[model samples]
Structures are given as C-alpha cells and as structure tokens.
Target: MSLTIKNLSFSYPDKAVLKNISLSNLPKGKLTVLLGPNAAGKSTFFRSLAGLVDADYEQILINDESLSELTAAERTQRVCYMPQIFSTQAMLTVFEVVLLAQKQLNSWSVTEEDVQSVDALLKQFEIEHLAQRYISELSGGQQQLVSICQAMARSAELFLLDEPTSALDLRHQLQVMQRLKDETQQRDVITIIALHDLSLAARFADNILLMKDGKLQGHGETEFMFSSPLIEDIYGIEIELFRNSKGSLVVTSELK
Candidate 1:
C-alpha cells in the first residue's frame, strides 16, 4: 500500500526540476502535501506520476506492483491526477459538468447507475441545488466546488490534487480541505496535494514533502517540516509555528 519512487529525476526543455529524488516508501492513507516555491518542480513531480512527462530515471511502484508495465488506461484508472485547475467551456449544467468527469461514461447519455454516483458526489459538496446551473455562469469558488465533486467521482485509490483550494475563500478553503481529508480517510485513498498555503498544509496534511530548487529537501510529519529555520529558508521569510488548543499547527510570520 504505497507509491515508491527510486532515484526519480526529471526536467523541462532547458532545465531540471527534480534531481535524483529518491523516496523509498511514501506512507499510504495520508494527505501528503508537496510544498515548494514557484518553478520549484512540484508541478513537474506531480505530473510525472501519471507519465505526463518523461522521467529520465525512475521506478514507479504502486501497491508493490511496478507501473512500468501498466498501460495508459490502466494507469489513469488506478491513479487519478487533478491538475492545478480545470477549465470547461461547454454550455453544460453543474450536473452535466460533473458527469463529463466520469470520462468512463458519456456526458449526455448517463445510465441510472452513473446518475446515482454523480448525484451523490454533487450532494457531497452541498451543490446538488445547482444541478441545473451552467458551470461557466457560476462564480470562481462555485466552479471550484463543482470541480472537486468531479474529481471525487473518479474514485481512484490515489487522488493527486494540485492547488485544490487555490481559488477558495478562507472558509471554503478549510471546508474543502477538511472534506478532502474525510473523503480520503473514509475510502482509504492516498492523497498527494500540491499546496502553497503553509498554514493550511500544517493544519490538514498528515505528512509534508518539502521541495526547494527542484530537490526534496525533507519529508516527514507536518510539525517536523515546519521548523523555524526550514520555513524561513524555504520561503525566504521568517515564520513562527505554534499549537492551537485544538492541537493543530498554527503558522505565524516571525519578524527577522
């Protein structure tokens, strides 16, 4: 029950983003947050999981089985990759938008089983009332919720979410993150979330993978990853970490 990457390395046209990164065993059943600065290769690393780009060297193993031999369709079904943001231009309703996410099914021609599944997902995000609303017409936050419902419908064992709450407000940010955690826990799905919000990451993530300059600087529990020096070094700004009465990690800006 793990995704193992050995000596993983990748790069773009003129530069490398990941350099000889080796993670022997990444724990399952946790929200693994990949944190990094702009152009730090977090996106590259996430994309490489699904073969979005060529990894010069890497041995990807899922649940002890090597993905080297799995077909494209096989990989897509086993591991779902939700990009930083999804765009939809079709004149479709909220329900219709989510139905398209079930790429395994037709957007307009859904069976009773498909409708049941998608409807349940929509309701989970508390957006069932918007079933008839056009996605393009919805607000940014509303659309993000719809996208979340769509992603959850994939029902894959592993969910790769990039900036899942980037456009969400403070309340929705927490709500979505919490919901994501609940859904993953209930289903025992491994979630690797690409995030920039250190406070939210500290609060919700079970484990944190710190990346800087395209290298995996550290990987461990949220508390360990947010050490004063580590946070300051990574963000080039001083920050403080404290514990709330609720036992959640609170990140504060520490003046240098």
Candidate 2:
C-alpha cells in the first residue's frame, strides 16, 4: 500500500496553512520522516490526513481509494494520529487507557484477552511496570509511550505521529523510533512521522519529506534529501553530512 496526496490544500478564513500540497507513492513498510521548521503546517497536514481537518481539495488516496470517501468511523479504523501532546488529567490507569482505546468505552468489562494484549504491548515498549500507574502521574515521555500503546491497540493501518520523540530522553527516543521502524516493517504499515531531529530522521527514515512554509520542498530517499543545500534551505543552517565508520549518515554543524 502507498499513500498518495494530490493537489491537497487546507486553509482558514484568514490565511492558508497548506498550499497545493502533492505527494505521491509513499510506500508502505517504511517510516517516512516529515521534516520542516516550526509552523510549517506539519501537524495540520497530519490532521488533514486523519480527517480531523477539512481540506480544500479531496485528493488524498490510500492504495488507490480516496480517503475523502471514507466515513469518520472508517477513517478512525484506518488512521491513527498521535498529537504532539495529550491531556493527562483523566483519572485512568495506563492499562485502562489501552483497554478503552480498543473498546472505546463501549463495554464496561475488560476481557482477559484485552489485558493480555495490553500487557504484551506495554512490555514491547518496556513500560509494563507502569501499567497500573495513573497516566497523569507518569512523565511526559512515559505518557507518550502509552499513547503509542493505545494506538497499537486500535490496530490502525496508517500512523501519523507528530514529534513523537519530542519529550523523550536520548534512550527512549532511540527506543521509540526503533520500535516504530520495526513495527512498520513487520506489519507492512505506513508510518509517517513529523520530526525536527535531522540526525534521527536520517538514521531511521526510509524516505524523507521536507516541508517549509506549508509547501513540500523535497521528497525522496534519505540519502538524496539530506543534501547540504536542502538542509540549509529548510533550516537556514549550514551543516555537513558524511558517512560514519559504520556506513550510517552522520549530520553535524560544526567544522572539524
């Protein structure tokens, strides 16, 4: 499956946020990093795909089916959008949150299979110890992981993560990205994540989409999109890109 966006645009009465955006053939089983500066409409674009925001043009196609044609419930089943932050004021445990996500509060009783599934998902993210803890008490990064677990519980076909690693420490950041990569490949799910960390994006992204000023600047493999000119153009910073001893791309701004 591939995600194809054609002539898609979203705007408010005052001004336009996304302009004539067109991206095509974003392949499945790979993590695509959406890179851009702040206020580049990355999050809004994710919302458009999630059916949270209306687009001026309805041309988003997933595997040749128009996303505009799907009902809200159908869209929810297919797409999972994890915003940059979430409200933690709800008095719910991590386990309960995951269970609720699966059943959507339709039933009061939680099944043993639901518990087992939630347990396995927590263990996969190494947050099983916090299963019984209240989500409001956990740290931001931990809560983000729970949100991921919730998304996983829903078994959505498309994952749209907005700065998923923003609050994570170095270790958890790597862990989350690696887990996403592994899951995307294993499940053949299309994962599109917005990220500001170029280094991490370079390392984990199978493909990269660079956006600026509500427009697509470049889209292709990591190697091609990580060029010096492109980096400088989007970020307004000079940087050097080179392969490490292990053949992985390393991005650094300092001169050696």
After the best TM-score superposition of candidate 2, give how far the Cα of residue 63 lies from its true spot, in angstroms: 1.9
Stretches of model 1 off by over 4 angstroms after superposition: 103-109, 254-256
- Per-candidate TM-scores read 0.93, 0.95
Pairs clashing within candidate 1: none
lDDT tens digits, residue span 175-255, model 1: 999998888788887789989898999899888888898898888888888873776788787887899999888987655
- Reference-based lDDT, residue 234, model 2: 71
Q: In order, what lDDT does every prediction score?
A: 0.83, 0.87
Candidate 1 displacement at residue 211 in angstroms: 0.9
Model 2, span 1-256: residue lDDT tens:
6999988898999889999999888999999999999999999999988888888775887767788788988888889888888899988999889888887555788889888888888999889999889999999889998988887777778899999888899999888999999999998989999999988998899999989888988899998888747867678887778899988787876432
